[model samples]
Target: MALDIYPAIDLKEGRAVRLFKGDMQSATIYGEALEFAKMFEDMGAKWLHIVDLDGAFAGIPQNLKCIEEILRTTHLQIQIGGGIRDEERIKLYVDMGVSRIILGSIATKNWEFVKTMARSYPVAVGIDARNGKVATQGWAKESDMYSGALAEKFVGSAVQAIICTDINRDGALSGINISFTQDIASRSGIYTIASGGFASSGELKILDENPYISGVIIGKAFYEGKINLKEAFALFEK
Candidate 1:
């Protein structure tokens, strides 16, 4: 299968921010949300991945307007996660034209909602983990669930993709945790998207070689200029 490289535009309080290991207090905004999305699209990116950091942490969407602005500004495929707990919010984003909605917290606590959304929309599940175990409540808190087991829960459902992040490696600019991702993908049947610790094009190249890794989300590396989006797209684009 061909791999897709998604440049991430994570918004917090209507601005771009890359949090350290999902820590809300450690966030710092980079730029206005809409402008960033426009720039990313202008860079030849076919898909953009955004997350509502405030909404994910608060358990209530606080960046809906910003999310909407991004959706309106770009014609690229947009996949978003954070604070998408109920069916209505899921419907709202899908109705608002988001290509995919990522289910995180609700994927563990209210799996039925996850299954329902996956069945109804082009839904993706984000399994954020710290040391091999899943974390919830916006990744501020840890959970007892394992990533593989979590993926298994939706095996019979319409879950089309899974985004697995190695939390400890996030925003640290260390490198992509390939072994961890390979483990998750090898154990699951659905498409797996790797996030966190993606520091350079070399790391992405490594993931591109894996048949199970359908996409890679590069956040800090993209914004920090450590990774080039156009080059990545050239290498992975179908």
Candidate 2:
């Protein structure tokens, strides 16, 4: 299978950001959010992942206009998450040309809703976890259920992929926990996209060779200049 790279553009108050270990207060702003989209597209990114951090906590999407701008200006295939709770919000984003909508809080709170969504629309589930337990509400709350068990629930359904992220490694500029990601992909028998703590071009090549890993959502690495965007595209795209 081919490995896709989703250059992440996490928005907070209309600016792009990267938070340390999923902490809401630990955001490090990095200029305009739209610029990131343009830069990623210029560097040959095939897909983009956007998160509405403010909306994730406020129980509603806060960066709709900013997200809309990115969509309007760029031809990048986009998948968005964070505070996506209701069907109306889903319709709003889909109608605006989003390729896929991710189910996060709803994946844990209302599993039946996720299953129903998988049946109808192109969908993915954000399986953000810390030390084996799934984290919800933008990683502010922890759940008793493990991430793998949650992935198993979507088996044989329309759920397209599991965006598995390890909160402990998130934005730490450290390498990703490949074993944790591997476990989820193997156990669930689903296309697993690894997120959090991804750094360097070496890791990109490694992810590409792994048959189970379908993609990786990289943020801090790209913004920090640890992974050259052009080099990443050449390696993963090849």
Candidate 3:
């Protein structure tokens, strides 16, 4: 499978931002949402991964306008996560042209809801864990459950993908946790998307060598000039 490159557009206050290790307080603002989305599309990005930081912390979506504008304007297949807890918001965004929805906080607390949605729509679950245990509520609360087995729960749920993040590596741009990422996908038997600490296109060659990894989410790495968009696309492009 081709390694899909996802340009992340994490929304903090209706603008693009990236949080260090999922810390809300450590967010680095990146500017307006629309302009960034168009830039990724122009650079040949196949997918856009958006996280609503406000929504993730507040337990409800707060960046609908920003999300909607990107959906209405871009040709990118976007996967939206954060602050998405109930069905009304899910239906609303799906109607707004979201290609897929990512279930995070609720996916851990309500497997039935995640299972239900995965069956009816294209959905992925994010297991944001630090040291193998799951973290919820924007990574502010940590759980005792192991990350790999937690993702395994979706085996027969028809889930499109399982996106796992090593919270410690997120936004550090040190590099991706390749072995850790592959373990999650292998144990779950699902298409996995690896996130956190992606540094360069050189790492893409390493990730592409592994079959379990279906995609990689690049954030600070892309914005910081550590990884160039064209070079990244060239490595992963089919």
Better of 2 and 3 by lDDT: 2
Q: After superposition, how far is residue 204 of candidate 1 from its true place, in Å?
A: 2.3
lDDT for each residue of candidate 2 in 48-120, tens digit (9 for 90 to 100): 9999999888878899999999999999999999899988888888999999999898998888898898787
The numbered model that scores best in lDDT is: 2
Compose the digit string of candidate 3's lDDT tens values, residues 124-207.
999898998889998999887888878878877788988999999999988999888988898888889999999887888888
Which residue pairs collide in model 2, if any? none
Q: Where in model 1 is the C-alpha error above 4 Å?
A: none
Q: In model 3, how large is the Cα lDDT of residue 217?
A: 94
**Which residue pairs does candidate 3 place in steric collision?**
none
Global lDDT of each candidate: 0.84, 0.89, 0.88
lDDT of 1 by residue, 1-238 (tens): 2778888888877888898877778886788878888987887888889888878878877888887777777888899988889888888888889899899999988787788778778899898999989998788788888887887787767888889999999998988788788777777678899999888877765776777788889899877889778777766657
lDDT for model 2, on a 0 to 1 scale? 0.89
Q: What does candidate 3 score on TM?
A: 0.97
Clashes of 1: 1
TM-score of each: 0.95, 0.97, 0.97
